[model samples]
Target: ITYRLVKEYNLMINILRAEVVANKAGELIMDIEGSEQDIAEAIDFTAHEGIEFRILKSGITLDEERCVHCGACTSVCPSGALTLRRDDWSLVFAPEKCFACELCVKSCPVRAIVAVMHLNGTVLAG
Candidate 1:
């Protein structure tokens, strides 16, 4: 989530996402939203252990209405926040497990999931 802006110019460089460290040996995910060359250079700047960058094209999307009788969210959820049940009613979304990463938001294919922002007594769409 680090943004680097060029000096003496109106150029702004942005790295959408990146994994700097991890205790377990696995691939690290990072989102970079800049020139491909620059992104490559930045990723190459460090030889981090278990860190690898994969450019995401059309990232994760969330599907709600179409998600009937499917407990995939519960099993796939790493935070154990999104749960499913046969006798259950509405989808219970826990804000605690939500790191604001927008993964669940994108995972919804029906676009039923939405992030609302309250500001100055007004609700805004996130």
Candidate 2:
């Protein structure tokens, strides 16, 4: 799959996480980069090949009204996507830095944080 994406479409793939158990089941999450046309073409090819995929929203969502800025998530966020502001101590969320690891979602006391996934180009509550 990777070889075809590279050789045929000239798209670059960065495999973030992959778990495959022979012919039983597998999950692969990756980042693909290329021109708009190339990406569309590559996606079309993948769809034709019957590979299920989703284009996820970048990072976790923070429900500001529910969040208390307790900072419990700051400690567990591996990518530093969740942090505390040095001056006011307010929680800082950097979605661009997040890789959707979901550690923060697990650590939040108020359940204010949730991983957002898009299905059919519409946001699904996480």
Candidate 3:
């Protein structure tokens, strides 16, 4: 029951620009951007659509300086929503698709995973 959807939640937020549905126990990856208020509103709409979901969190933290680029999160991801890419530049976090389970932070040999908390109390990748 894994699903993925990428939509820009910034421009037209009166309605959801995209939807991802997981009927059973699984993972979902959403790509969207907006303020906490916007996200909350959107999630509410999504809930009415009858899609179950979980959030996976990852980002820079003050406790750890950097991620070791281990693919632990990618390997153990049950829903196939989480992915670790080997980019030439750096580890890119896709907010839209992340479920925020914090598995990457938990299994990291080094403590580099930091939760990105928004001013509205919504957490994102820092």
Q: Which has the greatest TM-score? A: 2
Q: Name the lDDT value of residue 124 in candidate 2.
A: 77
Measured by lDDT, the strongest candidate is 2
- lDDT digits (tens) for residues 24-109 of candidate 2: 76888777778989888888888998887677554589999999999999999989888899999999898888888798899999
Q: Which ten residues in a row have the lowest lDDT in candidate 3?
A: 1-10
Ranked by TM-score from best down, the candidates are: 2, 3, 1
Clash count, one per candidate: 13, 0, 14
Query: How close is each model in CA RMSD to the real structure?
Result: 14.3, 4.0, 11.0
In Å, residue 96's CA in model 3 sits off its true spot by 1.3
> lDDT per residue, candidate 3, 1-126, as tens digits?
112222533423222234536564434454455577756656665676676544443343424246656656566545454455556533445555555556666766666665564433566546
TM-score-better candidate, 1 vs 2: 2
lDDT of each: 0.48, 0.85, 0.50
TM-scores, one per candidate: 0.35, 0.67, 0.36
Can you tell me which runs of candidate 1 are displaced by over 4 Å? 1-78, 86-91
lDDT per residue as tens, model 1, 1-126: 233223322234444543445665443333334565665565554334233444433322234555553443455556766766457644655656654455566566555555554433455453
Better of 1 and 3 by lDDT: 3
